[model samples]
Target: MSILLVDSYDSFTYNLRELIERATGCAVFTVHNDSYQLPAEQDNLDRLISSVDAIVVGPGPGNPEQSHDVGIIPHLYSKYTEIPILGICLGFQSLCLVNGCKIRLLHEPVHGQVSKISLQGESSLFAGIESGFDSVRYHSIYVSEITDNIVPLAYSEDGCLMAAQHVTYPHFGVQYHPESICSNMGAEMLSNFGELVQKTGQKRVADKHLLNVQPLILQFSSSKEFDFQFEKVSRKETLSVCEIGDDFLLLNSASVPGKWTIIGFPEPNTSQLITHSQSSGLSVGVWKGASEAVNQDLWPYVSRFMAERKFQPRIDDPELKDCPFMGGFIGFISYEESAPQDVEPITSSPIPDTKLCFTERFVATNENHTFVVSIRPNDDLWIADTTAKLNTLNPSVSASNIPAKIEMPDKQQYVESFNKCQEYLHSGDSYELCLTTQCKIHIDNTISPWEVYKSLVSNNPSPYSCYLDFGDAKLLSSSPERFLSWDDEHCQMRPIKGTVKKDSTMTYEKACKLLKIPKELGENLMIVDLIRHDLYQMLNKVEVTKLMSVEEYHTVYQLVSVIEGDLHGSNYSGIDLLKHSLPPGSMTGAPKKRSVELLHELEHQKPRGLYSGVCGFWSVNNRADWSVVIRSLFNYEDDLCSTASSRCFRCGAGGAITVLSTCEGEWDELVLKLNSVLKVFK
Candidate 1:
């Protein structure tokens, strides 16, 4: 069977698509609700609907009362009466509204809540499915009054309508998300829909214009050889890469759980890859002297840059193979850097939206395990000198209280923004809004950027902590969230949402007890669904490997979840997938586009800068790793276009404001996030 799932811009649309494909073992195609309305797309749209055996109106944000929100959905059910159809959430409400029922706003909205839903009566949609199952819901509106045509098939524990079916048509609807990872028997529900499709006896030919499938494995290189080819050094001695330097990167994992670190620095002979800026078009190879400029946007530009990476031989050392960053591009993508032209950044940026470095050599190490250095051909003398410098370098970097002042948005201003976010949440404009505020700090330049990075890691060692010195901008990050990472086989994303302060009395058990409730987990759940949607494309199957687990950090306990999907053939490159999933879902909210739009109005146009952006490396090998830049302080070279005697630094902090969030509590959380990094100044 071929199913055409009309996506209503919901985060879980892909989740539903995968579920149907898994349950029915059929080819499924999808299109955005407003996708084909254009005059040029009408014929293609008609051909698409005619090609599918069944149509599923996917759930999404907003009310069915608004025709623009639901798009061609009303026409699909009304015009194509003989075709089997299934409506979910927004789709469900759309079905009810067309059948002469009203979508009423819930007095108490349930954005990311789980509840028991019991079957109402005998119905083909619920046949063979377990009754009274826990299903995840992400809706703020409902349909309670059923007329003769609209019949309730299931109801929640509190008696709100959960599932319904049309008495005279092959149309069905469900209030809860059947495709949620946390929801039970989702496959069974989709299977029942398949059976209903069969009973309808619709004989339709599959569409020839199916979406092309791409290969998962990515392979491409600029040249057959790099400035330095992989070779082994004769001497074996552990060295400290902690020594501070200019235009270098340290992916520090010191004291962080189950982590490795990489120190990336440029070799003089390979100076072409010092800095990356997307402000203007890029010239491909300055080393060649007659290089050509590439006229592409940020993400596409990255894809080409990575595709043309210099080649390096494989290092068999168990240490180097496991580390994803064996030395490549190291830099930060500013928060608003990749925002499409449609979404204008509120804050005027102080620096280019992006800054990256291509390091020729790097050292990978784990304190207790192994230290592996990348060796190139004809560089024995350089390696010996570097090894000697690292061996004799002092590892101890003491913390200092160097006086610093912090600036912030006042309580009233923040509270007002918080209140506005609440209104948007209740009105269904967004499920959760990540409201952010930037803090400025004036610090004495007596301390170097590398020393400041050492202080950050010393104060709050996090799994994704790192330091970047790009000459123009220096980043000191102690972020704990892994935004996205990929190897040859699969792509993984770990999002950190909930936060709890750590004290002497806080135990792992206590943290779990305090952080596992519906209110606390709701924010995390919305982002989880959003990320699943983001990654659902080009996926064999996505899994929530770790869900809602409270992990301890230096200053706080956080609720983290890991979601991963296998990368398919060369159809999509690592950069392609990374760019497709921009803005990091956790930093945004559910129904991401709308939430991002609403946040523009709520955040008062303050630039998030590097905060909430991602930083890491894309290796010469087809692999990459990045961490969400958070809990960090950063500085751009002053007006002199160089580091000054005193530097002006910025720290960004924010909290996800959901319907359950209180203005004061959110303010406190924002303050806590800010203090987590600012304490390094002490």
Candidate 2:
């Protein structure tokens, strides 16, 4: 069986595709609603959807009345009357518009909330599904009145139309999302639709249908038969990895529990992959033996490079088993990455849009052991030298004094941006926006970058804490959020959204109570749904292993959720998911593309640079892990800093702006985030 899903440019289109595929055991393909079908003319539609057994008009963010918002959908409905169509959310609203029914705005919008809906009568779509079942909804408009051609199938508790079907055609639609993790029996609903297509007896079901996929827990992979050329002495407690090399890249999770800490040196003149609009072509940085980027896209070029090195680990030590990466590329991608991928960032910054370095020799440390490694399986000489150099442990040195005070973002500037953010929210242009601001910091030669990272992590211990010394510049991070990580073909993303200052009055229970409110919960819930959409492309089912729950960081309490998917389940690999879901959804709010646009105007067209960007590694062994650069400080070399007596750095902070946000409340959040790193200084 096969199905063709026409996307309306909504983020959740993949989620619906996954649900339908799992329910029917059929292959499902997705294409944009604006996908070159001759703009509502049937010249190309016939050839486009000719082989599909069913058609699903996926939900999106606009009104069906606007032809552009739902391009070529009304045409599909008019032309394919017997194809067994299924409409969801916005798709449901369109069915009414074309069938002489009305779509009216709800008294109150429900963006990420669940409600019980009762099935109206006998229908194959809801055949075995019980009435008064719960389903998650994200709609502001609904079919107000059902015409004679349409028969009502269900209604929400608030008396809004929830589900309906065409009286004469095999068309079905539900106002709520049947693919949502919170939605009950959604797979069954979709399976019922499939059986309807099969039975053709008022679309009767022969027996029973079931849907399944267990949520995966993110686990650090263990190494097997990893033959070490020499034993690496354990000295991580007293000796910092920085003491071994002057120019290095490190993902240090030493302060955080149950995480990998990898440190490696970038040899002078190492192979690099760099991209910027200023460059002549992406091929300029391509590795010697690798093919040049096609039309300047680095995605496929990098994909091929990784494919050639799909290395398998050779670690034999049980204590050294937990480290995911033995050796690979460690790098950063600017929030608005370079051309071929992005048009132009809101504003340019000192750092390159993309900078990655290949490191073949490195040391990986877990909770119990530090493993010295080289990518070459038989490089015995290099291993022996590295092992000897790491034999002695030395104590970490502290800075002479706090470098300097910060130049914080002005309160008035934030107030103006907050006002613009609210205007968009109230106007319905966006549901939530992750508003952010940047500040500057100065440091003298008295303190080294390593000392600063040591102090920062000591003061604010976080799971994703890191320190990178790129010689001319450095990054000191104490991020509590994990952006994305995958071992083999399984991938996971943990997004942090809602934040509350950890005052003395705050307890775990109290924090949970406060975070459960609409203001905080809405911020987190919207991102969780957006994440599901991002993972939909990778799997037939994206699992929420851990739903929105409050987690305590050093200075604040954050609402965190774990979303995981399987790459092997679909045609996509970890690279595909990573490329599409850039600038993490939690950092950029709901309806990502639109929120990013509004953020530009609200942020005064300032580039976030390395502040909100992710920094980590893509290993040669097909494992990837990264952390969102938050509650941290970033530095990039420039002439101003070189001439000045002190080096300069930038730190960013802000919170989600919703209708519930206020000048005073958001101001407090901004200060709290900045202070998380700033407190390490004077």
Q: Return the top candidate by lDDT.
A: 1
On residues 354-375, what C-alpha lDDT tens digit does candidate 1 reach at each position?
A: 7666666676666544343553
In candidate 1, the residue pairs with backbone N, CA or C atoms under 3 Å apart (3 or more residues apart, or in different chains) clash, namely 214-571, 215-568, 215-569, 215-570, 215-571, 216-568, 216-569, 216-570
Each model's lDDT comes to 0.74, 0.74
Off by over 4 Å in 2: 37-41, 104-107, 144-149, 199-230, 270-296, 338-350, 376-391, 410-416, 419-429, 444-447, 471-473, 568-572, 639-643, 659-663
What TM-score would every model get versus the actual structure? Answer: 0.91, 0.86
Quote the positional error of residue 236 for candidate 2 in Å. Answer: 2.2
Residue-wise C-alpha lDDT for candidate 2, range 1-682, written one tens digit per residue: 6677888767677778878888987667677788765645566567656666777888876677888778888877777898799999878888878899987766566766778989887998888878999888777677888799999999989898999999999888888988777789899999998887665433222111112222322223444423444356664752365677666677777554436677866666545544433333354343323324436566665666666656675567766656677667787766766212333332224345565667777777777667777765577887777677667656677653475857889899889889888766654456678999988888886666778887887788788777765543467888888888886668999998888889799898988988888778777877888889887755655788998888887788889899988766455667766777788888888777778878887887777877778888888777888888899888776624433577677899988887777789889888989988898898
Candidate 1: global Cα-lDDT?
Answer: 0.74
* Model 1 lDDT-worst window of ten: 230-239
